[model samples]
Target: MKQGAQGSAATGAGDVPGSAVRVPPQSRGAADADVDVDVEVGRERYDAPGGVRGEHTHSETPLPRPRPAVQRASVRGQIVDALRTALVAGELRPGEVYSAPALGDRFGVSATPVREAMQQLALEGAVEVVPNRGFRVVERGRRELAELAEVRSLIEIPVMLRLARTVPAERWAELRPLVEASVRAAASGCRATYAEADRAFHRAVLALSGNEQLVQVAEDLHRRAQWPLVGGPGLRGRAELVADAAEHTALLDALVARDLDVVRALVGEHFRGAR
Candidate 1:
């Protein structure tokens, strides 16, 4: 009914009551006729008494708008995220050199943002800076990845086992959503999303140990293990990702059940397969 009332009220001068009627554009004096009147549907503006515009009341808080610099920073962040994804997917080959301008062209962005993004990757050890050129994807040997996986297992397996024994089933059940998120990401076959979700799930589990330092070290190792390997198996297939994701669900189930034997076996197998 309110919609109908508003629609009829916004029709035109013919619908207005009494002296508040709007004069026809051509019949008004030259000064009045020269004024532009824009009436947008769904954004109707009502004229108050004496030809004044009524003020609209807002019940919601105004959202903050990002400024130009913030927008530029956001663009750079997006490029960094994309580059990391590419690195994980093996789209950026190890030992290969990539110029910011070339990558900028590929991403349809300016070279400045790409350069900034590459600088961030450099910090992350994913790429290294090349003077007078661009960045090169750091070549990671199979040994290096294997070693990282071993280190992660050394740190995480014990903590996970400890948590499985100590933490209540309800706490473990709270992590089901995170495990499901990893499964969804893996199913989509986006290595970047899956990598992040995977890390988040592990980090949540380790956080239950109440040891910030251990969690930080374990997370760093986990991330390094996911980097593209030199001369190793290429980008992992969807089936592989799905299998990896299923292990996450299985591990959570074991943890919730407080099954130490199953948790230990799954954790060991998961890290070994990660290499």
Candidate 2:
């Protein structure tokens, strides 16, 4: 009976030796290699607050890393964008020869891309690519601008008037955001923003016609018309842009009210006054 008692004491409550102890793998010491792997993968570990010494409970989360610099894939596309902006801003003067190499140096790029982009602009009639020479910005003096205004008025006015009379009021309501953008651009005297807003407004208006061809023609002409007047704000100054933006507001107001007479008057004034 005494020997049995001793055996029971040795085997009871983990007193038998290492083979009798029971513990979960998680409660064991964590490996330092695991922490290093987590940190290397942009993961962070944070322990719970006010915990016991043996309680190594932790939470792991992904941390944000620094983003690498991005670059455009197409040098030609970049060259084209820069050339068009310069052309529209009138930075490239009309009736002057600008060589591809010179323009390439100005843009800090190679001549090949510049030449390629100028070829596209040549097709747009914004520039003329001369044989053996570089290129020349087409002279768009006041008369040309006036003629462009006349063409736009001819195409856009009638379509806008028709849509005002027929299109649903809700459809026209969508123009509010675009008009607001124009107002902001005008206030800032940013020619590029104003151009974008103006283009969006006119394109949206023409789209209601259901004639894709007409919309395409009008938008193309709009881009060309915008390219000529590159100084401060085209024709006048910042005030003109503000005034132009106001005309857009007044026109929308007339459209919502379904007042054809007012719309006609506003459209006529907008195109004529711009000229």
Candidate 3:
């Protein structure tokens, strides 16, 4: 994460020369910082219905903060993550081709990492490589999603059950960050954040098996299941997302307790609701 003078990049509709704007993690350019930027911060004044204007100033309104940019090889993973969230939210349409160079430019990074990320997406079956053109999103359907869920269940559940029985409670406790991320994302109704956090949680859960391939396959299936939800973010309301986020907490509970019956039930419910 890049740390410096944090501002909201409030570049009005061509109103200001250098106003703060959120960049994807570390995608901010020196050009953006070139102009004299004024970020309205700190004090907040609210006028009441029947009172004088600027009468009350209690606390500052929470403005959207700038997202940090990542580094080096991590940028590839970040790009993949950004693309996945965009895919889930239907920002990238099916059957339409997007070039690696263009996407790299869009992300303010090099084509190499963007291409590498696209290759990973291709492995996940989220996109297909189109010869000289680029990658196109695979049209995901209900049948495809169900099959992905079934495969994930077959691969992930048995190993997860074994880990629940064998792994120590402290190990499960280590996953609190991932769980908390999902909780925050769900509460904020941010699909991109929730999806990435959900990915991290499931991948962390499967990593206990100590099988790299197992974790990879489970993550791939997880991504596939999420991409085609037509109105995915809209459909998953705060309430539904909160309930979904609770599952991670509940799963952790069962794992720590070593409750085989509850673990098994939760595992089943996870896949069921995932579809």
RMSD of each: 12.4, 16.6, 17.0
Top candidate (lDDT): 1
Give the whole-model CA lDDT for all candidates, comma-separated: 0.77, 0.70, 0.73
Tens digits of per-residue lDDT, candidate 1, 1-275, equal 12221132333432333323232222235444233222233334443333534322244232233254678999999998899878887789888999999999999998999999999888879899999888999998878877887888788888898998899999999999999999999899877778899899999999999999998988878887898888733557778888999999999999989999999999999998773
TM-score of each: 0.69, 0.67, 0.64
Question: Which of the two, 2 or 3, has more lDDT?
Answer: 3
> Per-residue alpha-carbon lDDT of model 3 for 1-275, expressed as tens digits?
21124444433222322343222222235653323222322223231222223211234343554443455568888998789878877688777899999998899998889899999989878899999999998876667767777788788788888998899999999998889989998898766677778889999988888899988878767877777554333555667778889998999999999998898888778777773
The reply for model 1, stretches above 4 Å from the true place, is: 1-72, 232-235
Q: Candidate 1: global Cα-lDDT? A: 0.77
Give the per-residue Cα lDDT of candidate 2 at 224. 84
Instruction: Write the number of the candidate with greater lDDT, choosing between 1 and 2.
Output: 1
Candidate 1: clashing pairs of residues: none
Highest TM-score against the true fold, candidate:
1
**What is residue 200's positional error in candidate 2, in angstroms?**
1.5
